[model samples]
Every structure is written in structure tokens, then in C-alpha cells.
Target chain A: MFQTRLEETAAQVAAHLTHVLDGYPAHPVTDAMRYAVQGGKRLRAFLVMESAALHGVDPQQAMQAAAAVEALHAYSLVHDDLPCMDDDDLRRGLPTVHVKWDEATGVLVGDALQTLAFELLAAEQTHNNADVRVALVASLARASGAHGMVLGQAQDIAAETAGRPLTLEEITALQANKTGALICWSAEAGAVLGQADPTPLRTYATALGLAFQIADDILDVEGDAAKAGKRLQKDADAGKATFVSLLGLDGAKQRAKTLVLEAEAALSPYGDAAENLREAARFVISREN
Target chain B: MFQTRLEETAAQVAAHLTHVLDGYPAHPVTDAMRYAVQGGKRLRAFLVMESAALHGVDPQQAMQAAAAVEALHAYSLVHDDLPCMDDDDLRRGLPTVHVKWDEATGVLVGDALQTLAFELLAAEQTHNNADVRVALVASLARASGAHGMVLGQAQDIAAETAGRPLTLEEITALQANKTGALICWSAEAGAVLGQADPTPLRTYATALGLAFQIADDILDVEGDAAKAGKRLQKDADAGKATFVSLLGLDGAKQRAKTLVLEAEAALSPYGDAAENLREAARFVISREN
Candidate 1:
């Protein structure tokens, strides 16, 4: 039942994004923008809506925040697949923007998407106070920028072609900045839109973020390429550090289970109000892909 | 005399930025961040401060805005100078970030600095009103994003390698997005911080931004290589469109003078309240490097 609702919200968010992005001038850059944002798993947007629902926030209001987060996620993917980064040719079973266009267009499209995220958030009329918008902007900026995802990416690149192996703690820190930050921000920003105190939301989101990464690592190790929709075990081949590397398969699975439990525990204070979010947390770890 | 003050303010802003940025963790990414932002003409910073002075805004308050603009400008330059874009080796007499570090570091540093700009504005205690910070963030995002500078850059790259001569109007539109948008944003943001209505400020800044680009074109045509700090006449060599290409050298010079006049006229309503900004307009055309 939750999966069906998640798919519906994901489709709605993508449809809205398509409408907002379609109005750009018909330049190669604008075309690249469409290419980068037009398709995705929409996982981040789902997390935002589900978490917002947990706080009794209107799903419609949460949709704006969800779309913004998804835009940022798309922008990161566009840049990440560049020749200088992962150099991947495929994302979501489609040609990466850099492959479809050129590197320059890919870079610009990513940049535009990042800015578009802020523009969407800024245009939100549902939030009556400018303070709410400011906080949301700050949340998104930190999650997407250097002190967060960018920094994590830098560490990941640095870890590559280096002689030394990264410690377990270092690996966790890197993932926390790169992947965990945005995941956490999506939930926290949704709570902000719900007018909930951000402290508990952040705490809940952090555990969920770790669980998300562990699940991703597990998928890369055991999931089929057709099911995952992209290359699997690329991280292992690249010598990129992961929980699977440090914890082994059984230990990693145990750790992921522990994280999901802790994430659910963090939402206990909200009781039945957070039922959707709790269910989402369970699905995050249990999904095959 | 005004040149001396501009230099002094640039130095002060640079010093403050250095101090603030040093507080980050000293990783390679952090070092790249420091290197990318450490030195520049600080033209945008100067414009912000000068515009604030014209409006009788406090110098100290103006400096905050100036620093924020400089950070954004520096971030753009770092990204612009990457192997994927202009591929320049030198900036302000030092090796560019990509040359000094790697391309990934360059990319990450640019992302970090861009975030730092908003973080600086958001953390400013002087800007007590949340609405003001929100406006600043929104304006910066719009100017820097796909619809603005990034889009401009995408078009510039596409046009440059397309092997066709672009029309005069097309070239101007490109420059308006690439160079003019950020320059106008700098001046208008200053005016906004000074609590002045931005409509007139934007009008003045837009004219000045175009004028500034024309001056840059003229310099590229006739300026000395040593003084200009980079290659000269490369635009013509690369077959890149410019005002000088569309309008012959004499015609371009005449258009530049006309633009300066129009820019000055935009500020006329403010009378003496816009003296410093008006002087800066004259200074732009007269600058040798």
C-alpha cells in the first residue's frame, strides 16, 4: 500500500518538475536541463512527502520541498557522471546528460538545476514567514554544497588512486557528507515545512540516512544490474570504501537492521502521526534494489 | 583617490575572507577552496561597496555584502576556468585551481565557495531581518543559476565551437546572461541591502554591466598582455563573438561610451546620493586593465 502511494507521489513530483522546467528557452543548455531532470527514482522527493505527512504537514506543501530536493539530487547526479568524476555513461537506464550533450552542457545543466532548486523554494507561497524559507534555503544549500555532498565527493575522489586505505570512520564520514547529508536534509526540510521542530527531525533523518547508504551498499553487492537500473559493484571495483567493505556481508546487514530500528525509534515521539515515515524507513532497508 | 579607496576595500575584504575561510578543516578540498578565493580584482566586491556608499549605507554593513559578492564571483571564476570551460592556466598572476590541484578539486572548491557565500549572508548578525537575507539569497541564485550566468556560459561554449558567426544581437544577449547578470546582481544586491528599492538600481546595474563587458572587449582587442594578466586577442583567434567582432573596433568604442552614458543616466534620479556609483561608471570605461 505504501509502495503504491510512494509511486504516485513520485510521479506527481516529476510531472510538476517537468512543467516548471519546460518553460526554459530552447537552447542546448535548456535541453540539457530537461535531460538531467526529466527522469529519476524520485527517492528523495518521496522521503520529503512521507516525513512531512508524519508531522501532519499538507502533502501539497511538502511537494514543493520534495521537488526542490529532487532537483538538487538530479543536479548532483548530472555532475557526478561527468568525465572528470564517475565518467558513467548511463543513469536511470538513460544516457547521462554529459553523454547526451557535452561536458560543458552537462556542467551548466547541473548548475542550473542547483539554482532551480533554490528558485522553486523561494517561489513557495505556502510558507507565510520568510524565516521558514530562509531556513529551508540554508538546509538545502548545506546539504548540496561542499561542507556536505561536494566535500564527500572530493574525499571519494581522493580516496581513489591513493595508496592508503581509508579507515572505517573516515569512510562513514565521507558517506555522511556525500550521500547522507542530502538524505537527512530532505526529511529535515519536510519537517520544517510541517512547522515541526527541526532537532528531532534531524536526529531521525541521520539514522535513516545511514541506513539508506548501507542498503545501497548491499544492493551494489548482491542486486542484479537489471533490477538496480545501473551498474552494480562499481564502488567495489573502484576501491571506494563502503560499509560492506568494513563490516562484511552479515555484519553490514545487521548494521542496516540496527539503523532502521534506531530510525523508527527516533519517530516514536510522534506516535501514530509518523506511521508513514516509519513504514518508509522499514522499506528503505528491506527493498531488493 | 577613488581607485585608492577601492583597492583598500578590496584588501580589507580579502583579509576578512581569508580569516573566515581558514576556520574550515584543512583538507585538500579546503586548501582548494582557499586557493580559488584568495586573490582576484574584486570588481564585484568594489561595485557592491561603491553602490552602498552612493546610497549612504554604512561602510561596515556594505563590506558584508561586498564579501558575499566576492565569494560568489570567485566561485564562478573557478568553475569557469576549469578544463571543461575556458581552460585558462593563469588567474591574477597565479596558476588556476585546476592547474594547481586536479579538476575534481577545482569542481569541489567551486561548489564549496558558492555555498559559503550564502552561509556568510545567512550568518550575518547585522542583517537582522530574515526577509532581507531571503531576498539576497534569491537574487544570487537567480543571477548565478541556469536562467542567468550558467545558461550564458552554456551558450557561450556552444557558440564558440559551432563554427558560425553569431549576430550582434545574439552576442549581446549571451553577454547579458554571462557577464551582465552577475554584475547587475552585485550592484542591485547592494542597493537592496541598503534598503533602497531595487528597480532603479537594477536598471543602472544592467547598463553598467553591458558597459563593463564592452570595456572588457576593448581591452581584449587593444590591451597589453602583461597588464591584462591573460592572453589578449584570443577571442578573435577562437572565433568567439564579441561586441568588437560584431561592431568594428571604432564602433565598439562608441557603443561603450554610449552605454556608460546610459548607465549614468539610470542613476540620475538619486542625484548626489549616487555620486560614488556614478563615478565608478566613468572609472570602468577608463580602466586600463
Candidate 2:
């Protein structure tokens, strides 16, 4: 059920992104922007849709935010894959943006995609109420800016240069900003749209985000390259500290499982309405990628 | 008077930016972001504040929008100066962000600064009305995204690699999107905040923007490098087409003067109340830098 829903959202978000890109002038940058947004797992988009469904927000209304998050996520990946950054040549089974086009196109594509995310959120088509849209934009900027994703990325780079393995506690704090901030934003987006208290969903997303990172660490250790659609065990080669390194593989898996349960329990207030979200937590720890 | 007011707004905007960035984690990225934003002309921020004053918006309320445009402009410069883009070494007579820091820090600092721009615009302190803030965000996205600044930049890169100079008409359209979009946005932001018609300010900004670019082209041809605070004659050196190349230097100067008059005339609707904006148009074509 979770797999089917995730794929469905992925297709819808892809179509929406294509439609949006089509409106811009035909140029290499626009072409690269279109290419860059393709083929992610769309877990962030699915989180947005499922959380919105739980809050009784219309899927059409929620779709805008879903596409926004995916576009924003794509921008981050393109820049992250730059030679000056991670220097990765491949991502999602294809050459990364800088490798496929040039670095200039990669930079502009990422910059424009970030702008497009805020554009989507600010449009009236996203919501009838201006307050909701403003709130959404403000929260997203907070999640993606210096205090959140960027801060986490900076810390990771600093750690690499420092030539020391991060303590388990320090890595936890870093991941909470890097990957966890956007995940929490995706989960709580529905409540923001519906103007409801988001405490429960926030709690649910916090655990889910941590588990998701741990699962990623586990995949880095034991996952197949073909299944993951990218390089594997690169962290181990770099001597970077990861959940699998700090905790034993078995211990990391146990922690992810426990966090999944905590995530499911946090959704108890909505009962069966959150079954899909519960399933999503299980899928997080179990998925190959 | 224009110089005094521009400097005043520059100092205030810098201080506000510092306070906002200080709230984030202390890291290399944040430090680079702070460095990247310093020492600009602050013309965009001045336009925002000056236009806001014309619409009777309070200076305190207008300061948020002023800081937002400056941040956005700063982001564009950091990215544009990257080796993958223009590869500029000097800006405002200082080393470019990538030259001062590493490429990765340059990328991250630019990314964070762009997010900061939207964050400033969406804050409740920018305006009491949510509708006004949303409008500012939407217009800014349009001005800065693929449809505007990015499109112009891509065209520029393509022109350079195509091994031909752009036609007079083509360069005009490119500059309209490149430099003109943000100037227009800054000029009309006050009207947007006051919920008044922006048509007149838009007209004024259109001419002012063109005159400003023409002046830049003229500066490249004849102005002192030390006064310009960056390398001059790069276009002539590259054999790139510019207004001064297409038009004789004298012709370009005359054209800028005509546009400044048009910019000034567009403010007739506000009578003496718009004196500073009128002076701004004159200043655009006359400033050394």
C-alpha cells in the first residue's frame, strides 16, 4: 500500500513539475532544470500528501506543497553533487547535473529551482487564504536556511576537514538539521495548511526523520548498488562516522525499528486515518534505497 | 542628498542583516554569507525605501523589504562570481566569495542568502496584512527566477559560447530581464506594501533600470577602474557586444540621459513628493560606480 501510494504521488508530482517548467523560456538552463528534477524516490512528496490527507486538506491543494518540496529537494541534490561539494558523478542512476551539463548550468538550475519552490508556495493556486501561504513560505525558509539544512551541510563538511569521527550525539544533532528539518516540514505542512495544531505530527515526523537517516546509514553498509541506484559504502571508505559505524549494524537496525514504533504511536490520535503514515514508518526502515 | 540617503539605508540594512544572521549557528557558511552581503552600493535597498516612502509606508515597516532585495541581490552576485559562471575575482574592490572562501562555501553561502531573502519578505513584521507579504514574495520570485534574471544569465552564457556578439535588440531584452527586473521590483515594492497601484512606479523603474545598465556599459568604456571598484573593459576585452560598442560612446550617453528624463517624468503623479525618486534617476546615469 505504501509503495503504491508513493509511486502515485511521484508520478503526479513529476507531471506537475513538467507543466511548471514548460512555462519558462526554452533554454539550456530550463532544460537542465527539467532534467534535474527527475527520478527522485519522492518520499518527501509522499510525506506531504499523506500528512495532508490526515488533516483533511484537499489533495489538489496539497499537491502544490508536494511539488514545492520536491523541487526544493532536487535543487539541494544537484548542488550537493557538484565537484566542489561531494564530487559525485552519479545520482539516482544517472550522471549528476554538473556532470551532465556544465557546472554553470548546475548552479543556475539549483538556484532557479529554489526560487520556483517559493513561487509555488506564494501563488494563490496553492491556497485561498494568504495567511496559510505566508506561513508555509516562512516555515520552508526556516527549514532550508542557515538554521536548518545549510547548517547541517556545513557541519558535515567541517567534520570531514577536522579528520575525526563524530560522536554519536554530535552526528545525531547534525542529521537532525540536514535531513530531519525538511522531513519535519513535509510532515507538518498539512497542519499549517489546515491551520491546526501540529504538535502530534511534529512528534511523529521527528522520530521518522531520525529513523530515515539511520536506514540510510544501514543501506550504505549493506544495500546493493543497483537497488540504491547510486554508490554504496562511500562513507565507510571515507571513514565518516555513521549510525552503522557508531552502533553496530544490528544495533542501528534495532534503533530504527524502535523509532518506527514511536512514529506509529505518535499518530494514535488519528487512529485508522493514519494507517498509511504508520505503514510509511515501516517502509522507511525496510526499503532497499 | 541621494548619497546621504543611500548610505543611511545601506548601514541600516547591513545592521539588520547582521542581526538576522547572528541568530543562526556560527559556522563558515554563516560567516561567508555575512562577508558576501557587505560593501554593495545598496541601490536596490534605497529604491525599496524611497519607493515605500512615496507610498506613505512607514520607514520601519519598509526596512524589511529593503533588506530583502539587498540579500537577494547579494546572492546573485556570489553565484554569478563563481568560476563556473563569470569567474569574477573582484567585486566592490574585494575578492569574490569563491576567491575568499572555497567553492563549496561560495555555493552554500549563496544558497543561504537566497533563502534569507524570502524569509525576510514573509515575516509578519514586514506588514500587518498577509496579502501584502504574499504579493511581495510572488513578484520577487517572478523577477528573480527562470523567467527573469536566470533567463537573462543563460542567454548571456549562450551568447558567449556561440562565438558571436548579440544584436542590439537581443542585448536590450537580456538586460531587461537581467538587471531591470530586480530594479523594477525594488521600485514597486513600496506600492505593493501600501496596497496601491504599482503601474507608475513600474514605468519609472523600467526607464531607470535601462539607464542604469547603459551607464554601466559607459563606465566599462571610460570610467576609472579604481572608481568603478572592479575590473573595467572586460566586455571590450572579450569582444562582447555592449551599448557603447553598438552605439558610439556619445550615443550611449545621450540615450541614458533620455531614459533618465523618462524615468523622472513618470513620477509626475506624485508631484514634489517624488523628488528623491526623480533625483535617483539622475544619479543612476551619473554615479562613478
Model 1 chain A weakest 10-residue run by lDDT? A119-128
Can you list each candidate's DockQ? 0.66, 0.90
Predicted structure 1: lDDT: 0.80
Off by over 4 Å in 2: none
Q: A1-289 in candidate 2: lDDT tens per residue?
A: 8789999999999999999999988888999999988997898899899989988898998999999999999999999999899888889999998998999999999999999999999999889999999999999999998889988988888888787899999999999999999999999998898889888899999999999999999999999999898899989999999999999999999999999999999999989999989999999999998
| The candidate that achieves the highest TM-score relative to the unseen native structure | 2
For every candidate structure, what is the RMSD over all alpha carbons to the true structure, in angstroms?
1.8, 0.9
Q: What TM-score, computed on C-alpha atoms, does each candidate reach?
A: 0.96, 0.99
Q: TM-score of predicted model 2?
A: 0.99
Q: What lDDT tens digits, residue by residue, belong to model 2 across residues B104-156?
A: 99999999999999999999989999999999999999999999998888888
Error of 1 at B32 (Å): 1.3
